[model samples]
Target: MADNNNTLRTGDVVMYKNQYRATVSEVNADAGTVKITFDTGGASTVPVSDVKKA
Candidate 1:
């Protein structure tokens, strides 16, 4: 399996389920999670598996 840390980072634009586009605001390698800030001014932290590079 690909490691989350190796796949994502802050400032990276990415895609998620439901066709949402988000920008990476933070990365927590220790937790295998990333914080994404959406275009709508909302933010969410999700597992790396839930996101992909846009």
Candidate 2:
């Protein structure tokens, strides 16, 4: 697979684990992680590769 760096960004809508839709609160390029705030009022730090545009 190709590198997906920079594919996700803060404020972008994404689908995460379990197919939940969430908004990206932050992006940590150095750590390759993203902070996502789910629509259901929850958040998590997940690997960038683990999420995709909703």
Candidate 3:
């Protein structure tokens, strides 16, 4: 499998669920999760593997 190391970070813009645009609010490498907030004011803590840089 490919490494997810260089894929994300806080303040980076990304697309989630293939639908909404979101900004990375936090990244917890130790927990393998990324916190993001969508343009619509919703937020979530998703697995690092599920997020892709926009």
10 residues in a row with least lDDT, candidate 3: 1-10
Q: Candidate 3, residues 1-54: lDDT per residue as tens digits?
A: 345556687999888877778999998888888999998998999987677778
Clashing pairs in 2: none
Per-residue lDDT value at 48 in model 3:
75
Please report, in order, the local distance difference test score of every candidate based on alpha carbons: 0.86, 0.86, 0.84
RMSD of 1: 2.6
Over 1-54, each residue of candidate 2 has an lDDT whose tens digit, in order, gives 334553887899999964899999998878989999999998999998788888
Cand. 3 Cα-lDDT:
0.84
TM per model?
0.82, 0.82, 0.79
Report RMSD (Å) for each prediction in the order shown: 2.6, 2.9, 2.6
**Which scores higher on TM-score, 2 or 3?**
2
Worst 10 residues of 1 by lDDT: 1-10
For residue 4, give model 3's deviation from the true position in Å: 6.5
RMSD of 2: 2.9
